[model samples]
Target: MSFLTVIASASLLAATGSDSIPRPAPSGPLVAPVALAVPFRAPVDTTKRARKAVTYSDGYYKRVAIHQALSWAMLPLFATSYVSGDQLLDKGDDAPDWAQTMHPIAATGSAVLFGANAVTGTWNLWEGRKDPNGRKRRLLHSALFIAASGGFAYAGSIADQAEENGAIRERHRNVAIASMSASTASWLIMLIGN
Candidate 1:
């Protein structure tokens, strides 16, 4: 036999504990196979893993729908506030300085929230329909919408307080509370559901 062939045979027999190779002594206690981490375990049952992933995806889509609906609901309210502010101020040729200033402020807050909602909602929808970009898009849009909604409500509340209108102040306060609750819920759902 060639020298290379003899060496290969010797190594193979040594690896298999043949008489040609001495075996090493055990130096540690024996242990059972480790329980794999969650991701690794999933591969053991491909179908189940696929189902769970699909469920997560579907729930994400539902959240997207909810985000869209909430955005739509906000739009009309924002439109009303913005137009009412403008119309009220426009009625007087020499509007009071405070009314003139407050109207624009109110309208501006309304517009900011509505615009932010739209931008975020659209991004979220696009993300949901696509795979590679879904997670990042969803997180970003959810955050943006929450900020927009919360900021707008807070601004509206401040405006109401500025006017010294008790009923308006209370109404705005309630609205702000509701907006905060929704934002919190949306984020929680996104994290848990996904």
Candidate 2:
């Protein structure tokens, strides 16, 4: 018979054998009694275990959920920044007060979104504690989000600064708008993927 078949047959025979008492003392040697122990444990308090399991699942859900939320939260800021920047460049002094106000508000919003994502992502990993893989993935997401946010923030700041100095006339403002768009898109994608 094949080796596997022989092993299987032996296992089957062993499993099917009767549970009858063994014959005592075929020879001279005396041995100590052996005890069989159960492998599975019944918990002393099952309710607590169930609660903890739910808590663990909730923690995971919250981490992913917040990241998803941050991604969405950034969309409007990005749009506002793009539209305002465009108007400022194209219409110059003719751009509405609201659009001009949006220049700073959009920059601030970008900062908030990026900062929140990084903080929350890091907190998720730290609070979870045991999953190294999850933590690594989160770290990558945090880094990307922060980098993208920083790029938009810095570029926006420079554009606004130049505007303050009458240096953001036309083409320069377009570059800032484009940079903000790319950064926001990058942040959104990173947050979504994570």
Candidate 3:
């Protein structure tokens, strides 16, 4: 997938980044999700765990496990941000003062979550680059994530500016939505590939 595919997912693309490649849902009992990768490396290829060559480092695995745990912990924060933000975006004008007050806080919450993703994500990606493996889907997924980070950052920075100017507000909302949507696509691609 190209970076354009990620950015354009706001309207122009579907799963796998482009409409050209349709992503059909798997039909059957729900399968397990991708086990999070090790913080600075990949885990034992559990699909091949029976092979002696694939082994896990307890210390490193634990470290990776912590990052993974934190990543999961972020979902609620992001969800809270999204829900509150929508409340603010729609019917914000007549909403109670408390609702207006909470909007920025919610956005901050999501930004905090994004911070975790940005830090650990880039760190892991840098480590992934040592090998030739990120050349395909990993490369695409990582690139899109970086782009999404920029989008969220821009949106977060302009929240105040948005309230004052119609143009700024529109831009803020657009980028924020696009960023989250694209980031989700990137995540799914990597997850399913794993």
Candidate 4:
């Protein structure tokens, strides 16, 4: 092999952590070769390891950017609504007036966030349908998130008609539990399957 080709091969193998090549063990020796190795460093594709280190991915990452933005807008709303709604559920009409007042406000925020997330997700799916670069798993990921969001919204709607600490509340809780479980599975599938 040519000299440059040999060096590139070694660098590529090292970059990939290939163990197929054996190395001689050093025994208390200062090494000029080691000292010279720096200039032959393997070129790294930093985008694979660090998002902020480099920018640019295919169409799929455009979807990811939207997902991140929606999450930032949605998570706080979901949390606030969930906590307040739970408190209201437990205390019924006897809940502290603040809890009663905040419950609806938080729920509204959650609903708006849910709508935003859903719209962004749908947009991603539409983009994927249009793009040759779209992977099947990414489409599945968006679809699954839509289903989970729907289930969550349905649960919330059911809760609205529920009497505090009553059967309908229990049902809403059950559905919410299932929706969260599905959401976890969807995330796992996207991360690994994608």
Point to the candidate with the largest lDDT: 3
lDDT of 4 by residue, 1-194 (tens): 34455566679788989867754444454333343344555558643443233333376576667766655564565566567667767877777787777767766665676676667666666655644443567666666777777888888788657764588887876676566566656666665654
Q: Output the lDDT of residue 129, model 1.
A: 53
Kindly list the per-residue Cα lDDT of model 3 for residues 1-194, writing each as its tens digit. 44444355535554456667543444445444468986775566744433223333454455456556665664565566566666667765775676677767766766776677667666665555544543478688778878888998899789888777878877888898888788778877766876
Ten contiguous residues minimizing lDDT sum, candidate 1: 47-56
Q: Order candidates by lDDT, high to low.
A: 3, 4, 2, 1
Off by over 4 Å in 3: 1-60, 73-75, 133-135
Stretches of candidate 4 exceeding 4 Å from the true structure: 1-66, 130-134, 184-194
Best by TM-score: 3
Tens digits of per-residue lDDT for model 2, 1-194: 34455455557668879545343333444444458877977678763333232135676677768876876877787788778877877677899999989977886787777777667766775666665444555565556555655555556557646665555545355555565565566555555655
Report lDDT (Cα) of residue 95, candidate 1.
48
* TM match of model 4 to true structure: 0.54
Candidate 1 Cα outliers beyond 4 Å, as residue runs: 1-54, 57-63, 89-133, 164-194
Error of 1 at 171 (Å): 18
- Against the unseen true structure, what C-alpha lDDT does each candidate score? 0.55, 0.64, 0.67, 0.64
Give the RMSD in angstroms, all C-alphas superposed, for model 1.
Answer: 12.0
